[model samples]
Target: MRSIQRLVTLGAAAAAVVVLGACSAPSQEPSSATDVPPVPTVAAAGPTTPAVPGSTTAAEVFGPGCASLPTGDDPGSLSSMRLQPVAAAVETNPELTTLNDLIGRANLAGPLNAAPELTVFAPTNDAFAKLPAEQRAALEADPARLATVLEYHVSGTRASAEELRAAGTSTELAGGQVRIGGTGDAMTVSDASGGTANVVCGNVPTGNATVFLIDTVLVPQA
Candidate 1:
């Protein structure tokens, strides 16, 4: 009878241990990555931003409004309008390559960074390269001349292509005049020397300014 009672107690203990082990097993888990919460994927295809309520990308609709204003296929929303912060703004713009190069050469990047509000008419790499070697050399020799020419493209007000077109002459941040005019859909800017630069892609918005992409570089008249 004593042996039988000990055997029964051992059996009960084993059963309880098994029951407790089964109860402590982890609860049902998601089977796959698909079961996880959605995450925004910024793929190589293009930039991806969080979906905004009632916001639209400029790339979705190409128009004159974006032509003169700082425009880009920015990842962020229009409400914020900042594709990148001030420190990184110039680097992100492919069209501003020449301008950036000049800025680097002139060491004006620091002064530009310090400005409160600025509008830049950024020229393509080809535009600067197109200039006569001697003329560019002369401009390089004179920092003031280089700066003045560069500043001609800059305006205090954030002017879109539409705004620039509407107002023929916009007062530049550097206290010079930037003229605007064109017959067809493509707008042209007449420099102080009556030379015109056609708009390639306009209105690329940055944190501090809008960039109007120009096919030709605007030479400052001294």
Candidate 2:
């Protein structure tokens, strides 16, 4: 009877141990991997500013002629003009009719179109009209001379209004230096002849060049 009781007690203890071991055992089923929250993805930072093809920022259209500029809907606006080459861009502006004609006559349209980058100081029709009759006749009579005069208005690089203001001077294709002055809307460009032309509408971007519409034709020194 004592042996039987001891055997029974041992059997009970073994059964309890088995129950506790079963309770403490780790779960065998697959973990809830799908139920777990996923780590969040981070996005990369963008450039502080995406650079426009020409000009630092959208230019503030200025001067007396600003009123005459094409409205936002017009095809002649800077946005639309930039799609065309410099010569074609100038041709679209009625205010620059004289300059456009001269460009055509001088056969400078080709060169201007071909140039990778340029800054053209385009004189208005009024500017050309202001030139002495003799000077106009001489230019019309001499295509080569007219071409040189036209070249005087161009820089080999794209020069925006801010750039011109910062540089204060730019060498023209005609081998003459043009002096730039003032800040912002008051910017001016002086030719070798000491004549100053106000940049009426500046930072005009075109396909091949940046154009600054001026009030006077730039004349190169002899």
Q: Who wins the lDDT comparison?
A: 2
Alpha-carbon RMSD of each model: 23.1, 28.2
Off by over 4 Å in 1: 1-81, 85-87, 183-185
- Total clashes in model 2, counting residue pairs 3 or more apart in sequence or in different chains: 0
Tens digits of per-residue lDDT for model 1 on 155-200? Answer: 6555666666777887765556878887445778878777888776
Instruction: Write down the lDDT that model 2 would get.
Output: 0.76
Residue pairs clashing in model 2 are none
lDDT of each: 0.61, 0.76
Candidate 1: count the clashes. 12
> Which lDDT tens digits does candidate 2 get at residues 69-151?
67664666776787888888888887888988998898777667656567888998888988999999999989888888888
Off by over 4 Å in 2: 1-57
Clashes within 3 Å, all models in order: 12, 0
